[model samples]
Target chain A: MYMVAFLGPNASYTHQAARDRFNQDTCVLSPQVTIEDVFQQVQSRVAKFGVVPFENSTNGSVVFTLDLFADIKSRHPDIVVCGEAYVDVHHCLLGRGAARLTDTSLSSKTDSPTSSGQATPTSKVPYPKTPAVKPVVPVKHVKKLYSHPQAWGQCRDFLSTYLKGVERQDVSSTSRAAELVAEDQSGSSAAISSAIAAEVHGLDVLARNIEDSADNKTRFFILKRTDCLEHQPMHRGAKVVDDDQNSFKSLVSFTVNHEDPGSLADSLAVFKSYKLNLTSINTRPSGLVPWNYIFFIEFKGRRENDGATGAVNAALRDLNNVAKCWRWLGSWESEL
Target chain B: MYMVAFLGPNASYTHQAARDRFNQDTCVLSPQVTIEDVFQQVQSRVAKFGVVPFENSTNGSVVFTLDLFADIKSRHPDIVVCGEAYVDVHHCLLGRGAARLTDTSLSSKTDSPTSSGQATPTSKVPYPKTPAVKPVVPVKHVKKLYSHPQAWGQCRDFLSTYLKGVERQDVSSTSRAAELVAEDQSGSSAAISSAIAAEVHGLDVLARNIEDSADNKTRFFILKRTDCLEHQPMHRGAKVVDDDQNSFKSLVSFTVNHEDPGSLADSLAVFKSYKLNLTSINTRPSGLVPWNYIFFIEFKGRRENDGATGAVNAALRDLNNVAKCWRWLGSWESEL
Candidate 1:
């Protein structure tokens, strides 16, 4: 059985994405504290693949992971971006389960990510009988809500309406928030976390889908060490990245060659000539020099393909005229 | 008295920087739980100015602050980036002061930034009677160390050599780490925090300057409300940012016109044509379009200057050929 790891305390969004993307029965999904730890585990051969968050719909791209990719490309041969997965992030207010589930009819117009099979309760506290589509939070009783900072930002509307004036404490991770509430078990304290965290930590789900945006989702990248790509079995639940699939994506990191005007535009021109569609673009410090930067670009197409291979070479040649250094991070099939 | 706020729990690096950059006697300095809180306080006019971490020598830019700048630009007219300050970070192992500063001679080759006026120690525990230059930590006596994640990262070298295998826990801030140690008052518990924390919390500096890097430093940006910039007084420890200073920096955010070939290069060319020396460049999701990004470029010279104003107008005119949108965040003197 292959071992896979994700950023954790077990119930983090990364953990949920890992479980959803990889086979939990065949692969041992371990959790590491930070994103770098996930990368290190894959590098050290302790895990065959590591899953890390790449971006979020509401909060935007995860720059740390992107910066790490830029850093690793400079040192290691290059990590392989094996596959991609999208996890619909559904946040819940987790409590002690002491209060019986209430307001079963208060479900979102959009259902929770996982529980279509069962009708889930939207809130534990009773509310005024209004035929509103959205659930109303019981503002007075919720004295405090604990969660990651991102969670607080995502749930601002719910917080303003239901938990307004309530003290919110930011923990390191959502899972940590659940863990804290589980340990404390105070009446007024609850956590905004993944529904799985409530299960893992033996907490109660007071409300479901509490995020301000119904379309909250996170994208994750499955990465493997460059040296051990071949002879490796498919990561339990991950799909094979086929070159024929239009879903394939190639990630490239490069730096501008000159401080001249339009230099950055020149490097990006290669992608246009290749007829590539960029999915994301990011810039991070080179770390070698103060104020220097490495640009990361993700475009649709596999490097292994005939058309892509030629485009890759052509782009590299053209970019060399305007960029100091460039490296292909990897190509993977990311199914939307 | 002007009110100034910083990210803190009293002795956080932001708090230290705020105190050093603003007059303590007149300005009422306050501690905030999050960086956003500082920004919000200043934006809401609750505080005349706020100080926030901008970049770290080792960790690179504090992206949150940068992202916040991009965000606020679209909403507010643009908060003025008034002045910059550099604080040399010095980490210390703090205990209850009950341990009797065992190795009074313990100190790193680099001392605390403010302790240069005093004699330095070279060891925390009783060592061989030799004139050693480096300070040593009594790792054998320490069972656990609490600190912010950044603190733990900065002090890895000391932890590995002297405190190998010791349990480490992450808190919100370094000051919180000291607060935890003070609350527990346990003989085996220590905290990696600022020297000022030990003094405020009545803890002893068991070991000083435990950070791995010798030149550990953090830079802070002083922020002010948009409407109040005209009548604003020079912050106590900060120099007035004259519009005419050659050290001025202009922060601009823009996006490529299209995914067409060389689009990004074309947008950057304006900088070169304008002869703007970009001191730093960053990229963030434009937030308007998925995967589309806004590039943040910080360059030497102010937007108000004759040369710079012409350059800005020229760059904007030239960039319109390739960029979708652009906004000048602010300009202020950032002397070396």
Candidate 2:
């Protein structure tokens, strides 16, 4: 049986994405401690596939994933991205015996900022003069909140509105936060975690979909060894469909001659010449020096058959002349 | 006294950078709980200046800082970056009653990776068959390691080689981690924090400069209200010397016409046309909609006098035609 690894203690967002992308009946799901562990598992052939978060719509790029890719040419060179999965990251406020928000009015009210389509900056007032509408859950009873650091940012509106000035403690994962809340004997702590984590840890969902953005989504990269793709087809149960732009996507990382003026522009010109639609661009510390950078460019194109005929291939060949160094990270079916 | 807000509980890397950039006798160093708090402090005019981390040499950009800028044109329009400070981040392992690293051999030994100059990927083996040299500290006594999540990635080699299988707990900041270790009654926890944090929290430095890269530096942006800059001069005693490049650096953020075929490339072409050297480029979710991005471009040029004569002014004028919308974030004396 094929084994798939994900960043998890279980029920984390990555775990949910892994389950969504693989058929449990055919593939055994394994939980790795860190994103690096997931990469190591695939690199060492311990797992046939690995799932790691690429970015969040609310937060930007997961720097850990990008940093790993920045050095891929030197380390874990055999791994390649095979597919992607998107998970709606709806967070819940979980606590021991906290009221399960049965009132639909609260969810709709809290989602007002999202519906207005304003990128609402966090309110200046921590406790905004206690809204006239009474909270279903007694937030004043809670003395501490627990979650991964990223969750605090995502739930900014909800937090500042109800639970501002409360002591917040960061844990390894949101699931771990839920676990800590479950173990707390004081009943004064709450956690921002997934509903599944609440169920696993036997905590009540005080609130649901508390994320400031209603459409908070996380993108995950499904990875596998490049050598294994010939025998192993795409995962059996992934539901990623080709959108209207039915084209393949490829990601490449490269460093231009920093000392030379216009070196970066010269490299970017190749993509335009190839008529490739650039989807995203990001930069990371090259790890070779303090200020030098490695740039990752994702563009719409195909790398099938690994030959020189494709536009992506041609652009890459042309890129070699302008870039001091470059590496093709992967090519996968486009989901945009 | 002038107040400078920073992201800290105190003794954090941000605090160190703030202390280095501001004279405490003239400017009061205030510790804000979060990066957002620091921004809000400046936006609310509660503080004359704010210090927030921009990027780390080992890790990349701090997304929180970038995300705040993603919506600056709408949210915090008055804030502008006036200067930047670089802090050499050397993490120390702090534990209550833990032996100080009196032996200098370990420091010299770990320096091998930095000296070799190869972007050293993490070793495959988690516990590499115990080294012949005895470790200075008793690793078996430690049950938990505490640090900010980013610190873990920076100290990967050291952690994997010596502290494999130890439980790691994430905290709000490295200083908070040190505080936790100092308060731990079990004496089984150690924290990765700054040397100043170890001294402040009354913890012994089990290890010094434990970060994988010898030159792990963090760059911080010194922010101030745009309106206040005209009345007051740069902070009392920031010793930012003009570098040999002797050019001014400006940061601009914009959203290109996504529907246009070559809108982004055309927008970038303006810099080349103006002969402005692009220093760095980054992208963050625009927050207006899912997958829509705001591009931040930092280039070496002058944007003084707020008129249309300068090359940067002319390029920005050209960019206005190509981009759907744009904002000039700031201009400051170049440090590079």
DockQ values of all predictions: 0.22, 0.54
Give one digit per residue, the lDDT tens place, for model 2 in A94-155: 88543433443322334333223222344564333222222345554567999998899888
RMSD of 2: 6.4
State the lDDT of candidate 2 residue by residue for B1-336, as single tens digits. 889999998889899888876778777999999898898899889999898999988787887898787764355778788777788998877785433334333223343332222233446653333222223555445669999888998886667656766798887689989999988866778999999998899887766777777889999988888888542244435545543233677889899766655677778888888888888888998887887789998888767653678788999999988899988878877554
DockQ of 2: 0.54
lDDT: worst 10-residue window of model 1 chain A? A124-133
Winning model by DockQ: 2
Q: lDDT at B84 for candidate 1?
A: 77
lDDT of 1 by residue, A74-137 (tens): 4335477777778889889877543332433322234343222222233322242221123333
Chain B TM-scores per candidate, in order, are 0.81, 0.86
Calculate model 2's interface RMSD in Å: 1.3
Interface RMSD, one decimal, each candidate? 5.0, 1.3
lDDT of each: 0.70, 0.78
